[model samples]
Target chain A: MNDQNGLTIAVVGATGAVGQQIIETLMKRDFPYKKLVLLSSARSAGKKVNVGGNELIIQEARPESFDGIDIALFSAGGSVSMELAPEAAKRGAIVIDNTSAFRMDPDVPLVVPEVNEEDVRSHKGIIANPNCSTIQMVVALEPVRKKYGLKKIIVSTYQAVSGAGNAAIEELELETRALIDGKPYEPKVLPVKTGEKHYQIAFNAIPQIDKFEDNGYTFEELKMMNETKKIMHDSNLHVAATCVRLPIETGHSESIYFEIESDDVTADSIKELLKEAPGVVLQDDPANQVYPMPADCVGKKDVFVGRIRKDLDNNKGFHMWVVSDNLQKGAAWNTVQIAESLVNLGVVKKK
Target chain B: MNDQNGLTIAVVGATGAVGQQIIETLMKRDFPYKKLVLLSSARSAGKKVNVGGNELIIQEARPESFDGIDIALFSAGGSVSMELAPEAAKRGAIVIDNTSAFRMDPDVPLVVPEVNEEDVRSHKGIIANPNCSTIQMVVALEPVRKKYGLKKIIVSTYQAVSGAGNAAIEELELETRALIDGKPYEPKVLPVKTGEKHYQIAFNAIPQIDKFEDNGYTFEELKMMNETKKIMHDSNLHVAATCVRLPIETGHSESIYFEIESDDVTADSIKELLKEAPGVVLQDDPANQVYPMPADCVGKKDVFVGRIRKDLDNNKGFHMWVVSDNLQKGAAWNTVQIAESLVNLGVVKKK
Candidate 1:
């Protein structure tokens, strides 16, 4: 309410999980915005949300919604973003999309500010955010990649249900209660809500996260593999991912095994490197039983890493566990950080 | 009993989790036995467990209690087996010990019947069962190794609470109920019941399983690493493990990435081989949404394999998911299968 002389910002998908977080994050970071426009689909247009002592009614998102907006944050479904992002950019608004719509587009720069902040300079009105699983991993590994030169990576994720959406979280909670009470519970929202088959995620682990590709990799797994290379600017890097959904609610945890190009690299050196890396917290004290866990990392912005150890056979290979909030650093905080980077780089000027 | 000419089998620690499964498996498999003896520690000595509709009293396990027994199965704690396993063996009873005390011993055989049944002939009275996680993985990989020659393996495990014991399962049930009810719950049994630290496993994933070794790998992780090497008889194979505990109650799932010695192998060939491999079921079908899940694998004795795919960058590398009932295949069924192998190999006489 006090930034009356700043740039105008609009938040699309204002009622969704990441959208709500984006609003909170904008307020938390004291984002320089003269007017914050809240927009959503027609189904949710009339909802009201309180923002810093001002009540804002959600409006149906349209091409005209970006009329005078300087920076529009789009996090609705991928189709909505695919349709609305270019229109927003056409109207002179820099759209930071939180969907997978324009991520792999040659014109769009997929940015993780800590890893590739300068890539924002090349954004064609729409800068893409990487996948939640990819964001935490690349943040933890960028320092090592910059120092030792990474050659390969194999990651298996223990992802929370919140990564699926709000309905999936509700399904986990409801199904867990039904199972605990010895009542029949039918799953209708996991492994992909619109997918044909549904699996119980309560007290169980589902190996599939999204629709499968022809090559047998899930879309989420492919995102991790592809997004890492794009953000790091290395097309030749070796990466593979197995993303599995767990009973967790918010954080995404990964077991990563990687090989560096140099043979002299040790786990200790990597630990020391991550200890000083930005947006990364090293939590690898096994003696005192200190390590990052999903429950402990909920709502945190920093990527927490622990259990760093060198492979017994390969001196160049190292293993670590990384955990972070999927909704925060993986989605909201990272998006807000990109906006801050835009403001710092003078991509968006204060009016 | 009907089998008047069959062997006399004694079950030590006959009241614990694996012991209960051992009894049920024997009944389910119709194991040939004349006199069935049940023995436990002094604390559980007067308890009664019905076996095949016959009430059997649990006697105190001692050196003399194993007299005239043809085969003895031990699933008690390590110290209990360290003290009583040798006693059972000295009384002319071939011992099948489930504790880790004698697994690495040069004179004892660590047997998974499907992987290395011939290793039973060298057993000097005690045949050891491998850890739950190790048993399922080695079973799934032995066929792969024999056909294509595995050179490297990196695994991340999604384990169940029952792998710890029956008490840990109870703790999961109680803690999950508390969390669902929005009440406070304390973790007293997970990661390691007696270990210094406890973490919430309800709606959370705990990376630490068992105590952390000096090298930063948990003891459970070390078990997966060491046991895989020993079972496969490849001391130089490169293996790394990140063992994690989830809230699942029965099945343990593993995401395994492996490099074969040959570069011409395809994902289809691996699936074809596992489809016919003993004690392994291939459940990979992405088109029909068929894959191995923890809930579906409960009460199953066979190891379920799915999601087989080739790596995008490495031609010789492959990834797959393996799941099995931890209590059955990982412990009781594997031990009973070892006994059946002994009977088939003519090592144990039924006269």
Candidate 2:
């Protein structure tokens, strides 16, 4: 089927926030797809989604959906990916999953194209996209780490509500409007959608992003800490993260404090390296009041880096601000880039 | 004035946000004032401000305004404090300044009552209130630092717009409403009121809180870093801060990562220490999903601390979430507390 025209691409959970972005990104990139298949739950199976100029119907996602697909992008949920990703892989569809289902698996490779593009080749059957917050941080840090060698990372994220899903985005909008009109609202989707308690994210900051793990760290923070090690392939690198959900709807920003292995490396050298690094745009001109901000990075795909400064007390420590569209670069763009990398590396070819 | 019926209290910048809070705090605390005088700029003079059913006229803050006052709380601006604080002090009024003018002065003490109440006695007529971000953090860290022996601190703040002033509060509300209504708005105030470019703060985070310094850190960030050392009276303590302004209107939240000299300290032990600390509230219960949040901490005077967790990689490192009302504990309450400490310590006296 792939050889008849070109590669066949299937997008699982096509009606979700990230799944929608994946479809848009696939169209925007003009991916060489012989056929594009959209899959969702049975409830949304007949939904019509227009990609560029073509209208396609979303089919119910199942094992048979990947019968003739070459590459499948999954972003619905962890459970959905867990249930159907292997089935798609078994049907010879190279699955680039955007869920946490296979990210930490020993046999799976979690890839951030800018940081670990080569790791995509080693995937057994599934290639996982790193977490939204982790993807931008690693993209900004990879260049610095390659030149100076990273020793420690302490990050605090200012993430958007969109990372929670489209429902969370609606909640933010509705709550904000209600609050503006002097109406009371019962928050039912934030902090964690399925958690016991929900907190308001309208003009408020909730310190917990995902559910808390046994170690007292939220799952989002643990994902950043663990996935940084897995994606960077450096378990010895000390990483600590505090993930918080802000009221923003699109972009995710992070304040990262890192210690380099070399004490003599200055902030200027790190900025210079990031200036030319792939998928990174340096915006660090403090004198002119230039820096990366979430609002400005809403629609862009590049990881924006700025506010680079050496720690006043620690000669080896440096701090930076990194921002990127959580839906784009963090999820959709990275997934599409991974699929592109697979084709470019000849790891997946027309069948 | 000291030999009158009781202490004569004056609140400078009474028309301002923190100033109004100071007047309210004075009334709430029943500071035993013989007379209360509200002072503001000449433009705001003759305005009436009602505090606890007492209608006080706002007078122009001048040297003469403090002639009959025993203690004058100044929150107008740094320039106003710089000019009038010394004049008020010369007229025998103890000026408790809530600006950055005299905070770093070698002769003036920067005080957070919970952390450094005794330092109030060393003030040369003018006692400076620490920055809002610094006050809450020091309040949270003082107990742990005292018991565990502090070495290094790195903090990233989710500060409220009220810390920037009342104008910023209006801007947040305006921008939020405009965005909700799908109307266009040109941000005139945010990040900094007089910044080169204004950015939207509603549903977004601005990395640059104040103007950037020569070293690429914002002035707000520097204030937290420098004021912490001065208030703690430990110049050798390693401190780094990244101060950010969130969309919140009142409370300021901080993600603090600190390294203690004692490697044997556990997060549970730290929580126990803070549970009994002065002007501190312990809300850490991971099982119950309890933690400190900015929205929940508004109107509260205590510094709320929770999410205590020891670092996974470094035994000496610990992370916690600290939050407090920026106006109360950060400014108005702390200023009032300093005045109370002065009177209790016999540094100032009522008739």
Candidate 3:
């Protein structure tokens, strides 16, 4: 690693699912990090993890943990970010947050670098990663937005259980096998497990992803709406999201409908733009039945998009299917990418 | 049984998946019949099925098979329906075709008795059952549309693979298990297998249901668009559908966004109308985390609806989810319901 450019990176909540992926992504991308720090809660602290062939011991995340860290990646939770993210930022570390804590904050820049990489420069201290469902959709839609100009968006997601957490994914597999074997299993971690009730995700579709707000939108829906506007810098863009958790174990698939600003925009033209778009892999050969799938997107970072078509009557209306590994591009890779961007933009300094 | 009202009933394609459900639905509903006839291909002709504790042998379906039949319930493929449906109708028997053969025919009435009981009388000789995806959405939305006029409908379906027939369901289960086990299995029946290539449906989403039509919409999407207009008798109403085959086995789920003519409509008002509507089961209780799931609706005859919410900033727009067993309400039960409607309305006579 070059001493002049390499920086020390700290991964908060390294033992967690998304946190583990963040470490793997950083290693797979061969990010230029001079040193790496792994931090978790007190319970998970002292555990050891194997990342990119290196065995690293986890330590408890504290306010003083960011003393010499050049970049801190946070995916513990919203509470952890609210408590420690600012602390790490105040210590002169560029914080890349994968929680909802700073996503809606006016000062934080919610970024999907391909969609809003320039916004990263304007961030005061923290950079927020959009929701997993929103991340894939924006990646697919940004290319279309850039070429055609987006006016409105309506998205219905077929999200995997992994987006909820690792336990939800395990629950899906266990419950599915139980149902196959004619055994009854109670659902304890779906449709917001912390909420009063939980719904079964075995061959079911749950419409409420997060708790409903007073304005009638679920917290997850609000994240897509608000985070999308922030990342695209288009508060006036009309966006409606119906987030549903399916029985899938990993990856998230979304049926996105959008109205472009141009009248003569065709599905073929949008397909061409996405074919050349960054972080996007077009799998839309309907003749050969090649389209995106969550099962196929597991462990992948690129957003998979297909089924691009114009509406029958409305010339400006279009529909597309967006899919990506929720744990990868949605959370981990995006955080690691932010770290990479910090070095590339010379925003991080070694202590 | 009263011989005067009793009619000779024939179930076509009696050995197939939907055919078996149609026979069971008829026997369970105690359909009026002087004699029950089961007809299939020559391969399944001698097979005997127990219907309501009675053993009925399947006979080969031929044009003359409808000679003594007073009514015919056809679950055969579209090609068989095209060949045998009119032949039975010409033999003085009312033919209820479950295939897409006569669905879009101007002379044929597509009926979901609950949605359009009056439309049943307009059937000249052949009646059509709407697509499985369309049947559930219209059944849930028609009640609200009747009270308040409907202007536009946009539906994105999280459809079950069972709608593609029993073979696709088997493929999904097999492929899913193979997927989890890190094995390779050939996909033979998904996303229109015969039309082109096949993709694994386990933990994946395929946007193409039926083959691509002349327009960009898949055949399944086009069927929903045209069938809704025919069944509701609303040629002017705007309808758009994006059908995706999920890995689920039986029940089909749809996310429908519709605009009502009245501007003062509320979500509560729509729920009230659906609660009292026929063949509708309101499972919406977001406060207590009660909503409909496809796994729970298996073998059910009624349409299950939940997650009803009004669109923000648009008083006339509302969104709801509709789910039902595709083989039941979407096909067999609806076919028998039309048979019952014919008997109740004196559209068919046994002398």
Candidate 4:
């Protein structure tokens, strides 16, 4: 579909879980697009997908797939993004890559629109989306950091299996059913599919998300720690994370402990700031037993913040519960938001 | 079966989940008992239970039920323990109450035998068992605190449904099956049974474990914080906890970050210390992908510790993963151990 007077949009890895969500969001939001192209790997290239009544076929994503594309969303693994993102950028498309390929690159701007929409304008063709867990936390924390300067962050994540991709979700279902029926099944994925050993995640929690680095932190944890500094543009801010995969299928939940630069900040003030913060929904009322829960935030695009409280001993410390759909706010929605920001900021022009 | 030379023992709430585990542990450990009596609420009073080929009828627990009983293990709800525990203690029985009714009472000795067995000597007849989550964490941290002189502690728990008792376990199962079958089911028992709203825990994480206090911390979190200080006998130790319940059936997992009083303590040294720590299993081999996981720790007695690493920027801070079966080590085994310790220390005598 080509209007020839509106923005031409392309979605790479369109057959994957996050990719499919990106397409759905674009249609749901009625995004202004002249042409919509869906691209995937060779294995899934020929599949037909129906998006809001339009039948589209997924093409093989290659370097030349970005022709005349004004905005390209890439989620086709790190290697695919590494090969095609820069190519798409060279062909006049603003590449919003969802993989970790260029996120930590000094030249690439890692943008969480709610936290760093301004960084999107400084992008050198390719804008990187933060990790699913990192995106939600930064969105919740940015409002606070802006009001009362952040000094330190300690986060523990209860992430969903969908963050690992489609196969892991299937694995969880199969393993859970097998366990329930007293049948035998093997776990071939989880904690990292290609990693050394496979552990059961049906009714359990695995403390390792991505592979462990030499420094003993998993790559997922390092992403949150390093990306927070990059997106917030704060090198002096102390951040530590322990990322773990739970049996959940969609949303990621985090228990965050943070210290502000000033001691005068109370939990109410933080809640007040977040109540009006863009892309955040405060669900924190303990009296009615209200708090952000992963299952409740499954398809929501906004980060849900709750369980806000001041630390009992530390006057400057606070705790919060953050929950968001790993596929939406964590990946697809943020990617689309960056593109939308590009147009709103007049950085991308319809050709 | 009366041994005639051993102590007369009674198990309260013996028909419930944790109660059954207590009977199993007692039978497995070959506890020295002249006579074994099982007691429950009036509704289940006439039920017969088989423990190690011995059939015993459950009697309604009452003030006079503790007559001639030297040791009474109480795990009925907090209200029941509040009503019956002291009465049993006054009747010459050393009450090892597993409910939270008297845990924080100044007169009741809250004891985790591995961490503070000596506190058992000053029990004032009623020895309170700490919360399941608190019991596992303190067991893991006690050795580290002893060797390194801990200064601060922050923990986030991935707790099991079993901690909420049998109905909650059934709720997790029914809810999970309903969700899997594309059916609708109401959450009646999670986060808190009597609280305002119930959230699904089948494929999600609930941040609120128990009722919220005025300061916004859940009762479960407060129990962990206050109980840690009391068990460690350090009023000055800084401790904070965020307790969340997972869909797990048995084991509870915790991510702990602590700062030692000494800066010279290394991750390797901490691992070395925990390797020989009593009732603590060191499973921190990241190279071979060995760490504590909830599913693997089910039915286990020891607190499994792993993923020990030093914080990147903070020299005094360290992180570790701790897991244990909430029913076994966290409640039943710990309660039985306290009774055994009393005998070993000559505090309990066979009349």
Q: Pick the candidate with the highest lDDT.
A: 1
In order of appearance, the predictions have TM-scores of: 0.99, 0.98, 0.97, 0.98
Model 3, range A98-209, lDDT digits (tens) per residue?
A: 9998898899888888888777788788999888888888988887788778898888889888888888888888888786667999989887879998877876778889
Q: Which pairs of residues collide in model 1?
A: none
**Candidate 1 C-alpha lDDT tens digits along A18-111:** 9999999999887888899999999999999998788999999999999999999999989999899999999999999999999999899999
Off by over 4 Å in 3: A1-5, B1-5
TM-score of 4: 0.98
Candidates, DockQ: 0.90, 0.85, 0.61, 0.85
Q: Which pairs of residues collide in model 3? A: none
Query: Which candidate has the top score in TM-score?
Result: 1
Fraction of the true interface contacts (Cα pairs closer than 8 Å across chains) found in each model: 0.88, 0.86, 0.46, 0.82
- Interface root-mean-square deviation of model 4 in angstroms is 0.8
* Chain B TM-score for all candidates, comma-separated: 0.98, 0.98, 0.97, 0.98
Which pairs of residues collide in model 4? Answer: none
